[model samples]
Target: MKTRFGKLVCVCAALCLLLSAMFAAGCGNDAHQKKIALVFSHEPQRWTDGAQMMKESLESDGMAVDLLIFHTDEEQAAMLTQAVDEKPDCIVLAGGDIKNFRDSLEKAKEQHIPIVDYDGLTQDTDAVSYYVTFDNYGVGEAMGKYIVQKMNLRTGGGPYSIEFFSGSDTDSNAKLMYQGAYDVLNPYLESGQLRVPSGQSDYAASAIKNWDGKNAEARMKELVANHYQSQPLDIVVAASDGIAYGVIDGLAGYGGTWPLITGQDADKKALGCIQSGKMAFSIQKDPAVLNQKCIRMIKAVVDGSQPEINDVTTYNNGVITVPTYLCLPRIIDKDNLSAVSK
Candidate 1:
């Protein structure tokens, strides 16, 4: 019995050695794969479809990702600092004003941890690794053209007007979208082709949604109450689907249906509203394509490969003009909302 027990112990030791070798090999493989850190402005669930797309696409590329979500600007900066400390192979930042972390981001850059600025953009900074996002100005232009066309269709030969609700002032994405729309719409407004009502008019009263539904609802309510007391509003141009929903809720009790509304993000609820004809249109941007491009940018940096970039608008961080990738935005109206929603 003693001899049998010794033999069993030897067998167990041999198996353990084999297992250790296999585990080491697996660990080495994992280490060989690049490590990526994703720092986002908000929680994943609260993330716009665009954010989700980046996360999914990066993970699909066999790169290990660490996500750090910050709820506030300060928190975002702190996370950026911490990520730099971790010395990740490459760090990806999406959303919010990244301006708060220029110093820390620079530190990471000095350490050779390239940063891929995803979605949101900051004024030319040196910490940016590569920029992967849409042509925000183009998005705004689309909105403007669409609004003009819709107004013409709706009013025929009559006078019509519109209003705007922008995202947070700090968000460059919001600014680009708003500016794009404004540029396109401004000409018509100047030509007297479109008359925005009064300060109380929904089309005239502008509020910052900050990309929060609650904030959007509150702002929309204010617009509704103010406009109802004065003249009726004809159009609402919201920066996002979440903001548009808020406007709809505010208009719910206005004693009349709302005027034509335009939104972006093509969220599920937005799709539903479009189907019912309550919402006029939404710009459809595929999150998958957005994310895939983001990953490509990140992988290029991680693997030390050159990324394809549109240099004209690339962010000139002190070290390099990181490549910027611009995805096109498609407008979705009731005509093809179903196909676009899918």
Candidate 2:
């Protein structure tokens, strides 16, 4: 009878241990289920390689990420309405489309939802709690400096004209990049070392591509058809490598391959183009690093800490530049392609 009692006690102890284990597992799963809502102004299907990397990196953090993709400001507003309704713990927006749903975001703010912005920046919206981005003007300056130095344009006897292809006008990054390049090349243009004849034509022949590669290509074809000059284009200052690829396609079969083309993004195809000497340089940005910085910012907010901004200023465009968190932008050419890859 004593042995039977001993066995019964052992069984009871084992049952208690099993129950405790189950409870611990449940607690862990619950802890891992924190929901984060990621709202994008652009469709996820058409997101750039950098944006796609960010999504993957966020998913690896053992939290649930609910991505609501939108293609237009109107679509973004509608999605923001829905996301606010869902009452997510955190909201991540791609850009300044914050204005589209300022009211809805205020509602989120009332509910204590933390907001993070990436890609493009937004202004003094109470809804935008944090901002993440690279140095837009600096990126362009880097590209411009590389081109000027590489091509030996300052000592040029032969004329070289770079066709500037900008991104979406609505995006602040596009404007800064274009202006930065202009600042770098303008001096040379005035000195008769670098030529931009298209400037005299009201820049009508040149086009703003809205960051679309196909659009850039179409515009390049139009320039080629116009036969703007007897000389071949010496440089194509593409806003992104994706657009650079399109420009290359448009300039195809023009009797001879054109001169140096500059692009940003350091995309795989862009790297390939560099290897083939079709592209002069690409700016390398690691989305993984950017994602890690964003995660840190979000976690800081969640931990009841405020993010540090380098400097905050309001641009004339009414867009507020909150603390600048600019990442390192590297210059990539054929020699450095392998170093910048995944």
Best by TM-score: 1
* Candidate 2, superposed: residue stretches over 4 Å from native: 1-34, 41-63, 71-75, 95-103, 109-112, 123-126, 156-158, 200-207, 314-319
Among all windows of 10 consecutive residues in model 2, the one with the lowest summed lDDT is: 200-209
RMSD (Cα, Å) for all candidates, in order, is 6.0, 5.6
Task: List model 1 lDDT by residue over 157-256, tens digit each.
Answer: 3355566887776666777787788888776776776676544323224646457767877766765666555566777788888888877887766765
What's model 1's TM-score?
0.80
RMSD of 2: 5.6
Query: How much lDDT does each candidate structure score?
Result: 0.73, 0.72
Clashes of 1: 4
Clashing pairs in 2: 123-320
- Model 2 per-residue lDDT tens digits across residues 1-342: 999999999999999999999999999888756677777755223244445555566678666667777777788898888888887768877753455788987898899898777757655465567677777788889877877887787677446666788766666677777777778887777777667656621233444645678888887777777654476677778878877888888886465446788888777777888888888888876676676677777666666787655546632235344565666678888766777654
Worst 10 residues of 1 by lDDT: 198-207
